[model samples]
Target chain A: MKELSLNILDIAQNSITAEADLVEITLNETETELELSIKDNGYGMSPEFLASVHDPFSTTRTTRKVGLGIPLLKLAAEQTGGHIELTSVQRSVDPENCGTEIKAFFRKDHLDFTPIGDIVSTVTTLIQGFPEVDYVFTHRICEAGSEKLVALDTREMRIILGDDVPLSDPMVLMWVRQTLEEQYAG
Target chain B: MKSLEELAKIRERMQNKVILREGQASTRVAVGMATCGIAAGARPVLNAFVEEVAKQNLSDKVTVSQTGCIGMCRFEPIVEVFEGDNERVTYVKVTPEMAKEIVEKHLKGGKPIAEYTIGAAEK
Candidate 1:
């Protein structure tokens, strides 16, 4: 699977691109438990889209026949004793929240988002937002049994990290490298 | 464990450079990212571009993004270069190492590496 952060970023970005109004990113860590939830309020998925979102063979558009985003998220979750789940609803939900959701898992040590040295980026570009489709994101890095939460706003992200922060950072790169070596090593 | 206030500092620093409008149209690099592409190791190729572009401080001039695929399975992990009024330049079979050349040669030097393009694959 792509670095955990990229998967989250991908799903969130897709939601916004589809005219979603709100995207949520959450990272939950426990003594031995880690989970990620990326949800969006966009157009929601058609039944057809939902069925195919997890399939490696499905095509997102005529130009492309497959998407590795979800597949990568699934792979990452299973590796660390977790998995990926997707749910979507049409107009039943608000466009701002799109009613699209993806959840993934990882072990305490197996998780990484680019900034922490994994091969993924914690920052996702809502390229299709603002003037085109005004949107907001609620990004949280949390821990179980701990009330403390780190909420990040899109505007503020570009500031502290500098506009140059690659979606994948050294922290994320290290995480991906270590996980791959651990799983594939002989 | 970083806090939200820290993010405000980031926003304040970048307030002047942040543009909220679309269609301003910055240079963009799209990397193929289908299952086949990933299996063929496109992730590293994409990461290389992201890393190299940022290292060069060219983020403002180039937007590095990923798309599912570009329809050539046999030659997966393709990178398509787009700039002002220029025809699309497709580079096939890329690696992280090759990405460095693209950044230096094509992106900065204004010359597509025809040797590594699909046109080369056709022959």
Candidate 2:
């Protein structure tokens, strides 16, 4: 994906594309563990959709079905001994629009070092405006001896810089990486 | 060992803020989501928008959305600003910091930041 964040963002973006009303992205970090989870209230997947989600050739839209994003996510998780899960809800349309809920859960508990997911900031940096989608990024940093949580607003990055910088800037990435390291290692 | 159950508390506090109300249609900040954009790291850019909009309580004024490649793959991770009745302003090579600038200058000041805009490149 564009970056780790973009991959996550792409997933979240998919929810909005699916006409989802709300999407939640949570990044949980602990000294020995770091977890990334994103959920959405969009039209969930179906048996057909699920079967095709990772097919690299089958996607929701007819335009493009490169299923690289999900596979990449799974690969990222696996790299750190983490897991990925997807659950979908089928929208009946008659009721409150039900759909499948796809979840990709990643957990790496046996590693000598905490396998941190390096793509947290990428997810946070992509969506600066166009507020239809609500994204939450939670970093629960667990150090060797202590644990703390750092919560970042996706919007503040924009308000502070005043439109002079783009999310792709190395400085911005530094800030995000530093923030995560500070919470995880500081 | 925090469980999803604690998320309920989060839901309670968040509900008080009415975080789920789908505001009336408003201007949206759309990003290119093609394979190229993804390869160039468009996710963080998107995340920055969603997180920032929610944190600043701009959920009513803006919405972060994604679309397929606008055929400007040369400028991967492109961000487009579409305000009411105005021509779209396209920003290329956006980083999280630049995204912040957009929120401050474009979203808040209502002026496009020239340094990052395509039109500004000529000068």
RMSD of each: 7.6, 9.7
- lDDT string for model 1 (A1-186, tens) is 334554555556566655665566666656566667777667787888788778876645566566666777776677666677788887655544347778776666654422212322333223211213323333334445544443434433334455443213333233333433343232
Chain B TM-score, one value per candidate, order as shown: 0.85, 0.83
Q: In model 1, how many backbone clashes occur?
A: 24
- Report fnat for all candidates as fractions from 0 to 1: 0.17, 0.17
All candidates: TM-score: 0.63, 0.54
Model 2, A44-87: lDDT tens digits are 67667687676666765555545566767766666656666777
Which tens-of-lDDT digit does each residue in B1-123 have in candidate 1? 334454444445445555632345368888876555665667678778877876776756777777765678789779899997888898899988999999988887778899889899889
DockQ by candidate, in order: 0.28, 0.10
Candidate 1 deviation (Cα RMSD): 7.6
Instruction: Count steric clashes of candidate 2.
Output: 90
B52-79: candidate 2 lDDT, tens digit per residue:
7656667667867776777666676799
